[model samples]
Target: MSVDEEQQPSVIEELTDVHFKFEVKEVLLELTRQADQENTLLALSVSQLGAEGKMRTYDLTITSYLRKVGLDYCEIRDSNNQPLHLISSSDKHGSDLLKVEYTKADINGPNFQTTFDNTEQNLKVELSSLDFLLHTKALLSTINYLNTAVPQELTASKDREAKKQVEKAGQGKTVSKGPTNSNVFTFKLSAELGSFRVEVCDDRRNIADITIQGIDGSVLVQAKETMVFARLRDIVVLDVDPKTIHKKAVSMVGEEVFSFQMSLYPNATEGEGYSDTSKVDGKVTMRLGCIQIVYLHKFLMSLLTFLDNFQTAKEALTVATAHAAEKAASSVRDFAQKSFRLSMDVKLKAPLIVVPQSSTSHNAFVVDLGLITVGNSFSLMSAEGFSLPVVLDTMDVKLTQLKLSRTTLKQGSPQTDIEILQPINLEFLVKRNLASSWYNKIPGVEVQGMLKSMNMALGQEDFGVLMKTLRENIGEGSKEHVLDVNKQVARDKAEQHQLEGNEVGCLPVEAGGGGGGGQPAAVTNAGGLGENIVNMLLNLEIKEVVVKLKKSRSDQKESPFLVLHVAQLGIHTNVRQYDMVATTYIKKISMKCLEFSGRWL
Candidate 1:
């Protein structure tokens, strides 16, 4: 005998009793897009198990479009007392590997085959058969094998005693033994796709496990189906408007149906198959709660209703373009100043020759000397002894040659005992050494010519005289003659002053403070010698001037006659001379007094 039977007491007892009944509440299937054309593996599981005993097995057959597509036969029941299990099958391969397993007492045998003959005629069919002739025989064989070597009468008596004890315990007390229970179910279904396993467990009161997986055993969806029982006394029904219900229903199924049609046909646009209500009903019924279903439905419907509202899109595009432009402008401006400086070479750090002069010095140099900026046009100094603002205008500057000129003068004795003068010119060339190699080979002859022209235009005669004197005085060969002439002119002037008895003395005078003084002569003009000479010259006006000539014996020629002219009291005097005397006066008085005297004074 088995351990359980051996341990059984002569007087048996039952623990407790509970009853359960399940009814067809509702069925819902939600499909987002469409079933794959290659067929998909789907699995449904009893997420929860409630009853203590093993659930009775049944056949499941699904039919659509007048075509049968399900397992030949399948039986699925809870294996453990838990309230959840899984059931799965594929739709790719034709249904052939489907099988059913059940309690021997609940079926004709340990396994049963499902036939699709009835499913071919009905689009939907659920068959729950209770024939257990073969199952009962198997259960009896197991019981008998376990309870061996016991008298029939004793077995009957013990069974009755056990029943009595179970009844007595239930009256007021607890019992040690409990009834045998089963609550979990695992099975496999065969479909056009492939075979899939299903597991069910009963852990909670009324929840079932439902899972779908692919042929390669990839999990797709997992769901928990909960069965809620409401007593008639406690049930509350809410009255909803028919219009509201219809609107909610339409909203709930719009996208789902559209997406389904789109998946079925690659060319389908949005809202395809929208008029098909069956697709909408299929998804709407799957919502666990009415409120969620309604909300989703309304949202989908609103999305379609206002899909043409493109004003916001236009505004968004405008704002994006504006932002892009702003960014581009900022980027350009960031380097604008630097780029300008580089291309123009006008920035502060560019190569510069800053000849910074003090205000006073610059003003004096530019204004007093009539100097101008050689290359740059802007003034560095103003006449008011202020630094002039500088502005950059161009970049080309050529350094040219600079030239200097100098002159010197000397005195000579003439026939009237007056002095004659000779002048010398001096020139110095200053050439610029430019850094550029190109300038080294080019002679600056044009530049030198320009300088010479400018000097002549400024003051040719004065410059020539001054330059001639400077050259004679400082030239390499005639330095001694220049010095001696200058000394003789000074001595002659001194002697002339002495002959006139002009002694010079200075005395301070009340005047502005710059060298304010008075001078006195060496001798007063008591004899008026200078005045007498001036009067004698002024009184000499003849009606007809005559010229006389003398011959010099050594020259073997007779000199021509010479006459003199003088201006007296605004009356002009004219004189004529011929021969040597005329030549002598022209060379002596005319040249010396007119040219030399004016320059010297």
Candidate 2:
């Protein structure tokens, strides 16, 4: 619920191959990068549309990840999601546009490219542009969406690439390598709007973001489980054979029972993404469908159970890392079989949120979160030997159906000029931030201390039994439990939360949109992160992502929806710049970005 974020993309303004200039107000830079999430930058600029005429145009730049904005015809637009006028049809990607670039002076090397001194009027360089690139017409169309904006809202740019990536991301996993050549097409979508009663014209296409916020670690747990599944999927490509999968249910935390089944198409036909036999477009693909149980704590333990030397820290660490990883690999290899599509009788939400209609009797306390069944394809065709990089994709799992239930939460802001290092709506990265802090204080025993602390102050003594009773009352319950727990936890969170978990996630950056997508009404602040702790920079590269669009610096008060794809984004500010800087970034996190999103090169 930030005051600055007004993501109203009704129209896009185009600046053709103009000599783009930028000036980063230290205040805007300081406030946004420090106050808002990372990946968001606000700038003041003037670009040229024609080389023949010295026509300098001004722009209020608000962007994240995206480097340059090109208008199709070099025209600008008005607040109404309509174009004021078209600039020139001669506009195109190369000469008519996309000429401005910036080159970062490497810490130890000279920036032979365009170096940004960051003056009010800076020089445009062919050296570097932005991590993302956007155009006018599509952008304007996206911006025009603002006229129809809603209260507490966010939206994704409808760029073709962005649209395709989102469309392709139908709940599946992609093979992630270091940093693929992909662009961020979305931006953070959280907003505080004066209008909304928001209704999607196309429920199938305009699916709402998913929010996960229950007292149970559904958000956190599911995140870890997905990672485990991704890893196993990676291992499967090596074995080159799919097997029949069916595992018995195992109880978790004495409440929910977890089980799994995964089946791949073209059964033992090896080299799907490798040999010509499976080639679809000079590439092979192994279509897979998987269903795994999602018992928050137990499924976690099962993964740990795989390790050779396994020990669970009853305090901070909930699952065994070494042991679970091993077992998970085995499970995935076994589950990666040929042809078996998962069929469900439940109604499907575009990106469905399902909860197991049935559970073990012992699961008296069902958390209602099942393993997120994302049936996407993974690329196994590579020259490297098992270079494990997992991508998030959307697909149909041909095996078992997973269950999950929840709503979405929103957050975001616009920009200022600063070198970007992308960070967006990652609710789970809170664990990384907390982990970073723990590593800072006590590298060895930090995890244990953190777990104990986060749970300690939130619930009342009887809340446990109350939850137990409530679970029994509606064990296989409605979505109310998740919502109630999230709200109650947010309300009960100690006004000042102790920093002990992992410090993960980036700035609340560039243009996409994330109005308060289903964020509970009662919640006012990012859970766990209090006011004092509000900003961060990891000085690290993100290896995986899921966004697919780029946007321009528009007058929209809000930042563009931050895309989950791209290697780096946002203004690069050192984390240690100030403790508060790191804290501010951490404070804007929400729970929706973890399970279902991203892009590929």
Candidate 3:
């Protein structure tokens, strides 16, 4: 028979209650055999109804072996077996049997309470020992069968005989049997619970292939293999704690856990309506044995190990990324420093020189002489002419002297005896002149009458003569005389001195067709021989020289130029190589050139 061809059992259509009674007799001799015996009461009640429609009830009674206490009443003991109270009850029906009222007992050591429910319709009893209660119920059920009313006992025996006859009739008969064929049983295991259908195959060899479905005919357990057959005992145990199965389903399938909920109707037809019925919230537990349980443990362990490895790999990647970022930033900083270093080399290569000129009609000067490079531009100091006094404020030897030379000059008359002073040693002057030749052009202009007048004021010494000459010619009137000469003199005199004292100084004697004579022939009739000599000296190319007159810490003079300044002697280029060099340093570096138009006196 295939599964579909098998007829399913019909559900019970109604409920029936059958009253039950039992007679129990204890052997008196067995009670007397124990020493230290006392009257003992055994408390029990009905606990369950069996599948075969049997009812069980328990009678609690007390018996005494001693004649002193007799059997007048039953003594009740607590759950701990200690006597607590005496109990008795009357039967109004005039029977000798005692009625047992439901009561309670407390066990102090284990802290538990035992109670009994004694309603006449349905009796229930609880005891400290669940095993004792179960045994008592089983005994009562057995006795109830033995002591059933004669008519009911006869009916029960006839039913048993009919079942045996049916089995006998089926024996030796050919019943179609195969894996595909099945016999199904439909029943409610308990009131208010969902219905169940168990399908069994007809072939004995394939008997282990069973399936249990819910009320809606959805399959719950399909036993297609021997392992499921061995799980029969676990399946039966799982029925008690169905929530365990729900939890497992939730863990495995998450939100789909509810899809496996047991239905309330077995074999429910499509579109069929159900009548009003009591419903219960139930669960189903799938009890897997040791093998499946071990498998779940290993699966969880492997999952945890995989997570650990993933975390370690992620941490390593993070560290590598951080290191790469640091290295890149460091490289950028180094490259920037290198680029700045390359740019600095170009900026330091160019040098600058500044020449500031100051002039008046009688004299022109290069004042505030300064030579500057990129390193020392800020140290330039301002002064009045090349010979202006420079105070020695610092002790460093390198800054001992401010180097200076004449830029432009105007010679005074022979009578004026004016002279320009040298401001440094003659040795250093030679070095400067060697470096440049621009100083060779400064002209010497002389008015012989002016020089003779200056000589009359002096006592004829060189220093006195030079001072007297400068005193007369560098005065304010002398400057006016030099500039206003063309404004009053004849055009011939002005033209004769045109190149001599106007914009350019007097022309050189060689250019003027004079032999090595010291004086110019143009001034021969204006002054005496001494006057002519002074005039010639004035016309000599005299470059203004600077003496950086520093006072030496020792007694020795600080510079050779100090003596020339003290003597008021005009520095001549031929007297010292340094004078010539200093003249060149000034001409090349100064904005104004020194022009010489005659020989020295």
Candidate 4:
């Protein structure tokens, strides 16, 4: 079983018996616009908050659409086999709609189970092809409405103050503002740590004030009038307390909220001149119950058989886009319904590892992480249309121990910069070094310029050819089946290995097949671009390596954790396939080192 699957039962047991129901219907909303020719359709001239306290109305229409287009009736139940909640359309919409139900079973014994039942067909297929642009516009419009929907007097005063601040800054004057001063735009949130508020002002400085207050309304944490800057062009703010967030969330929604972080970028359209492209980089932590996740996993596993059908549906939608979209929307209102059944079996594990030496002895590295968790910071640059690529200026990964536990890795004494751009358009540059230890002065390495899109990094045509080759060679099977085959192959090869032992033994043949000539099956099948791709992907280069033994507390010589240090390490892969299903490709890898001593095992 996968690691997640093994821990699924305990994760479910942590949940208390509870149910949830959600029903979405048509909501009529009124919106005001700047009274102009371009926005004159069905618009109302209502006073709104604007710069300089001006009452400017635009000619914009008030449009309303169903929020969740295809949802009908939904229901959920808890572990005690009792109904949690049921949500259905109102009497005005009538009775012919989708209905769904879920049953959560106890995880005490092997017989425990869970189930999901739905009566409709093609619901998910149609939902996948929705036009997200329209939905996004609607959501944004709603938020804008909410932000401006305040008392006219309050809005006017705030707008006038903001205008004065902007005018003063334009004249190169610093108008001092207090930390508690309210701005034109202010947002408040009740979180676990405390009640936090952020005030954004309209000025050249683009500074913001962040304050946290206790339950009694006393200030707890405050970052007053702070200018926002980041390594990534986008400015992101996160407000979350992992330890107490669950408790706070339960009081709000009555459910076990999972770990999550929120990111808000203020100036998304700062750099784009006229390009109509704005990037909103957000990290939303979904509060999906662990019990629900376990059952969802099982349901998805069951749907593997319908992969071909889904592909066919996608192609059909592509051919008749409008017709398929309309049909899918109608099906949700008239046919499909929600249905579910669930059961779970959770396994337990003890935390501590009994043998310390055994834990670190056999592996090259214990942990490997990149920009994923460095200072909780991220950089996001926008791309035109639907393509948003990620570019990492510098990437680093540390190995806990090299050859032995006693030795440590360190950086070089003198730092030297290196840049390598390959003939195939692959590039690498190392500019800095690693850290040193108290025992000695060491050398380090650094590499820069890590940016590429999955398909664009390797030309799309070349990537398609590579994927075709891989799919042909590996064939097709469920994930579990493929893993089983790999394990069996490793076992067979290990048993038949004879190079070191010098024992002559017959080579293993393809599974369920008779022995052929001495040629290996893999070589015979992997022809054409297969061999070239493997060779190109495996190429690695390293600069400068030093290995030394250090004395230990036991009064004897022992191997250090850092066995070798490379002044520079470079890896260039013309085409690296990181994902099989999504077919993601990465182009380059490079980095710098510590200041003291650095080495590898």
lDDT of each: 0.23, 0.25, 0.23, 0.26
Candidate 2 segments whose C-alpha is farther than 4 A from its true place:
1-21, 26-279, 282-601
Summed over model 3, clashes come to 28
Ten-residue segment with the worst summed lDDT in candidate 3? Answer: 338-347
As for TM-score, the candidate ahead, 2 or 3, is: 2
Could you give candidate 2's per-residue lDDT for residues 269-329 as a string of tens digits? Answer: 3244423222221111222223223232222222232221112113112222332343333
Model 1 Cα lDDT, one tens digit per residue, 1-601? 8888876642232221333333222233321212255321222222121212232332222221211122111122234543111222233333322222222222222223233221111121222111111121122223333233244466447545754654454344332222122121122222222222222211111111112222211111101111111111111111122222212111111112110100111111114332221221111111111111111222222233223222333444454454334333333321211001000111111111111111111110001111111221111111132122111122222222222222221125321211111111212222222211112122211111111111111123333443543343224224433444466467558756543632111111111111212121112212234211110011111122212222234466433223222221122222211111111111122111222334421
369-402 in candidate 3: lDDT tens per residue? Answer: 1221111000112234322111111111111112
- Measured by lDDT, the strongest candidate is 4
Of candidate 2, the 10-residue stretch with the lowest lDDT total is 446-455
lDDT tens per residue, model 4, 422-469: 111122443221111110111222333332211111223323433543
Comparing 2 with 3 on lDDT, the higher-scoring candidate is 2
| After superposition, candidate 4 runs with Cα above 4 Å error | 1-258, 262-301, 313-372, 375-392, 397-571, 575-601
Order the numbered candidates by TM-score, best leading. Answer: 4, 2, 3, 1
The local lDDT score (0 to 100) that residue 235 gets in candidate 4 is: 16
Which has the higher TM-score value, candidate number 2 or candidate number 4? 4
Judging by TM-score against the true structure, name the best candidate: 4
| Residue 140, candidate 3: alpha-carbon lDDT | 31
lDDT of candidate 2 at residue 498, scale 0 to 100: 32
In lDDT terms, how accurate is model 4? 0.26
